[model samples]
Target: MTTYFVGFFLGLHRICDQVMAIKRGNYRKKKVSSTSWKKQLKSWSIRIVVGFFALSIFWVLCLKFINPPITYLMIKRGFQWQSEGKGFKIEKDWLPYDDLSNNLKRAALAGEDAHFMSHNGFDTDAIKQALEKNQSGKPLRGGSTISQQVAKNVFLWPGRSWLRKGLETYFTFLIEIIWSKKRILEVYLNVIEMGQGVYGAEAASHYYFNKSAKSLTKKEAALIIAILPNPRQWDARRPSNYVNSRANNIVRYLSHYEIPD
Candidate 1:
């Protein structure tokens, strides 16, 4: 999997460089012989296409097998959250899809990925935006949707390096291909890191709402989703003004967003 992404990224880098050169009108001036250049371009094109296909296939396979316990292992090995100074703890108690208010799903999806149902695994536009913004300063935008989060929590490690990213890409493809939207959302609810040493919807609800996962109110659910971006610092129980503002925005938009029957 590493090998595949390495090749794919390299191929993409070349494509980007070539496109930049073309934009600068230097592509026609390069002396590397037309025949060789054409052949190389064709080869890279094929490779990029094939690599993406293989990546999608691998992601589907992993969804069928790989799970979130890998996150537990990473935590057990003393992987602390660097930014927030916290650890994650998971507790499982599956909430029936009905018990939770419909707005909860809308809030999470809107907060994370508005187009979650449409994208396969990755949101290229979101990634592109993140890249551009991160280049100017520290990265603030994360393009990961519920599906990718589900994959990361269940199958991938948290190294925050190239290797972890590569594995994450592979596993993101896995969950998108193998699991239903419901399954992906379910696992996300059960495994997402909510606070310092706090994980799973049940744990979060018990701690924040003084209730079970099944009893979380729409406002409470919105609060939970609001703190997800940086659960270590943000507290759903006592949200800052920003989190509170975002939660209300989610509620305002909820009626338009529909949940599947």
Candidate 2:
């Protein structure tokens, strides 16, 4: 799988470089012959592709052991809030998989991805359902799995562009191949935005309930998970009727949720 991706990326990179070279008049300029340009482009492209692949692999491998201090989303949101003069400060604390409450994990699985333990990286059934709903003229929805969410939150920037989506898919496969399920869940809980300027289970627990994540009750965990769809818009600290209702639904679902061993 890794070899296939590397080869594909290299092929894509070579095509792009060739197009760029042509656009820059390498084919027209008498100083460089077409044959010479082709050889040079191939050589340089191979070198650049190898360098990028090595660096990417090294980075992903390192994350298996080292926790990231901050994510691109955190920095981007922080800058935006600062520009708006919202007095935003990122509050986050990294907790190991065992340190967080079981309810929180179960609640998250219940609220976000019910088949998280089974799905590889994408959830086909959820995607098919979303497509059907959209076709029926309902509001558009995403079928992004927990793995994809972690990929976007940890490595990629947010957007709906094809380029962004493609990169998200690439990273999703990488993490699923390299990191364990527990590690993926731990990273998701620790980095996912819970509220404005609040991140991670520990930070969210403290911000909303003034307690540690491990001490959160089932209801509290559900409430925290309820605002996940739009944490900035939904306030877990002062949950509206919709948020409260969603929390209740999540709690009910939690009873049937089985945490992956």
Candidate 3:
């Protein structure tokens, strides 16, 4: 009877060992599968990021040679106007860099970015001043340079978020690298909003002064640019005292604002 009990005990121990081994094997399989899935997920994530970078670069490169038929801002504005029950109109006409008025170019530089030809894509001093003013709780001001503005107007949506700012910086760097100073200014003048429904220097010149862009006088150009900060509210044809003041200041700067050859 003792011998029989010992054999039974030994058999029970063997069965327990087999069950534990099977569980260990199953755990190893699950761990391997989880690791493989994680690796695949990481690989796909990298691929998606690479694809986006490539596409963005291609988009920027194409714009260097081709004028964008429309922009993200234009679409947003159209939708916004329609939603608000306001009639929507987008007035934009593409003009070559040389065809644009010299006075308009100078006014743009003086009023928007005085150091357009010298700076890379950003103006450190302007950014510093803007930061200080915002810290002091003054009305929100922008320190965006021409290149930065072009980046936002052309490729990005308007926002003050960190993500939008980061993308703006990235596109500005690309524009400064891929395009000439003349091209940058050309694009800026062509895409910048000038009135409620008017876009670009050509349209604004026609809409406000009833003249061609190339014929825009210094004062006319300055007045148009002066109201650019709030185009929908201010009319260049009937400018307020503040607008006139800003235009006079811009005109004064134009004497010293030289466009790069």
Candidate 4:
């Protein structure tokens, strides 16, 4: 009877060992599967990032020679106008680079980015000043260069998020490298929103001054540019005291500006 009991105990021990072995095998398989999934996800993420980089570069290169028929901001503004119960209007007329008035260019440079001719795609000093001022709890202001504005208006949506700003920086760098200074200014003048649903120099010139873009006088150009920060709020046709002061400042310093050849 004792020998029989011992044999039975040995059989139980063998069964337990087999079950343990199976559990170990399953755990190993699970570990391998998890690792494989992670690797696949990482590989796909890398491919997507590389693909976006390549595509963005190609788009920028094409715009170097080709004028964009419309921009993201234009479409966004169109929708906004429609939603506001105002009839959707997109007034933009593309003009040749040479047809753009020198006075308008000078006013833009003087009022918007004084160092436009010298900076790469950003103005470090202005950014530093803005940061310092914001830290002091002043009104929120931006140090976006004209190049950055072109990037945001042409390729991106309106926002103050970090992602949008990061993309703006990327596009700005790309345009500075791919397009000439003249081309950058041309695209900026052609795409920038001058009023609610009003885009480009030609449209703003006709709407505000009843003149063509090439015929904008010095004071007329300065007035138009003065309302640029908040064109929807300020009217160039009837400038307020503040707008008039800003326009005067821009005109006073207009001679100091040098347009890119």
TM-scores of all predicted structures: 0.66, 0.83, 0.95, 0.94
Error of 2 at 52 (Å): 3.0
Candidate 3: tens digits of C-alpha lDDT, residues 115-180 = 888999999999998998899766547799999999999999978778889999999999999989
Better of 3 and 4 by TM-score: 3
List runs of model 2 lying over 4 Å from the truth. Answer: 1-32, 135-140
Candidate 1 Cα outliers beyond 4 Å, as residue runs? 1-70, 73-92, 96-99, 137-141
Worst 10 residues of 1 by lDDT: 82-91
1-261: candidate 4 lDDT, tens digit per residue? 999999999999999999999999999999999999999999999999999999999999999999999987788788889998997789999987899999999999999999998999999999998898899766547898999999998888888877998999999999999999899999999999899889999999999988899988889999999999999899999999999999999999999988988
Worst 10 residues of 3 by lDDT: 133-142
Candidate lDDT values, in order? 0.72, 0.89, 0.91, 0.92
- In model 3, which runs have C-alpha deviations exceeding 4 angstroms? 136-140
Is 1 or 4 the stronger prediction by lDDT? 4
Q: Order of candidates by lDDT, top first?
A: 4, 3, 2, 1
Model 1: per-residue Cα lDDT over 1-261, one tens digit each: 999999999999999999997866765566546768999999999999899778767655654545434365336533545334545433445465556556567767767777777888788899888788788667345777777777666766555676777777877766666777766776677677777667777778888888877666778888998999888789998999999999988777766665544
- Maximum-lDDT candidate: 4
Predicted structure 1: lDDT: 0.72
| Candidate 3 local Cα displacement, residue 53, angstroms | 1.5
